[model samples]
Target: MYRTILLPTDGNPPARAALDRAIELAQTYDATLRVVSVVNLGDAGILSPETVPVDGVRQSLRGRAEQIVGDAVERAREAGVRAESEVVVGVPHVEILDAAEDADLVVMGTHGRSGLKRALIGSVTERVVRRCDAPVLTVRAEE
Candidate 1:
């Protein structure tokens, strides 16, 4: 009984796996797919003396996000599903949770990290899992 499905991707292997699963689910349920990629501009705390061009980095990241969402939308369309894409600027998990508010379900890929590695790097999928209200289907990457 899904009308809208949210697929959040980072263009990684695991995210690709989730994308495949999302396509299948959308096809089966005749649901509209909403593909999204979030460009995380870091918190406002860095006062770098090294003249790192902040604007250039943001632009590059935005371009990559656009390409990623665009490609996913194309694939979904080719699979005969109604699809739309969005490139958002914010924290990955936060943006995903916000986007999922209008969707019936969220399908995401898990990076499958654990222990210290997971703690140190942090897991966007895990954070989404913890805070998301919609039903989330997490697909793990092939190792």
Candidate 2:
């Protein structure tokens, strides 16, 4: 019943697992896949020095994000699924939530962290699950 499927990736193994699942669902439902990779500029801001030009760092992250989404879009197209992708600069969960607004469903991967570790590290998937309006299907990373 899904018309549009949202898939967010960071080029990680967990995200790769989710990409596979999202592609499968898109194929089954004849849905258009929307793949996105967000560059968390805040993290870079904290690590970068005043001497380092922000534009250089942003361009680097943007390039990487573009590659991640481009690869995902290529995979989906190779499987004969209609797909589009974008690279955004923002907080991961916030950007994902914004993208999810137009999606019929959101498919993503979770690290499955729990308790103290989870609390300390936080989770983008968890935040998206909590805030997104559309239905979210989470694929856990294999340990």
Candidate 3:
């Protein structure tokens, strides 16, 4: 029932399973895969002082994000699915929700943090789940 599936990866262990699932779903439905990684440039910026750690950290984070998306696209392509990827800089939940506007579904993973811990730290996946324009399928990561 999906035409384009948006998979947001953080290059984390939890995200690997979700990426695999997204690729499988795309293949099964003959749909396209769109992978994205957000750099979260809220505090880390390229314009920071040249010698400040933020500059290097931002560069490193962007490189990692690009690699994650590129790898995901390659994996999807190898699976015979039409796939594309993007690297965005913004709040993870915001970028993901915005991207979802053009997607049919969002497939992502959750770290399974709950209760006090979950309350203490809000979840991007949870935000996307609550505010996404399209349907979202959240897979729980293994402990």
Q: Root-mean-square deviation of each candidate, in angstroms?
A: 1.9, 1.2, 2.2
lDDT-based ranking = 2, 3, 1
- What are the per-residue Cα lDDT tens digits for candidate 1 across 34-125? 99999886731134345777777778888988999899999999999999999888878889999999999999999888999999999999
Please give the clash total of every predicted structure, in order.
0, 0, 0
Off by over 4 Å in 1: 43-50
What tens digits encode model 2's per-residue C-alpha lDDT throughout 1-143?
99999999999888999999999999999999999999996855647779978887888889988999999999999999999999988889999999999999999998889999999999999999999999999997788
TM-score of 1: 0.94
Q: How much is the lDDT of residue 72 in candidate 1?
A: 93
Positional deviation of residue 97's Cα in model 3 after best superposition, in angstroms: 0.6
lDDT of 3 by residue, 13-69 (tens): 778889999999999999999999999976576567667788678888889899999
Listed in order, each prediction's TM-score against the native is 0.94, 0.95, 0.91
For candidate 3, what is the lDDT? 0.90
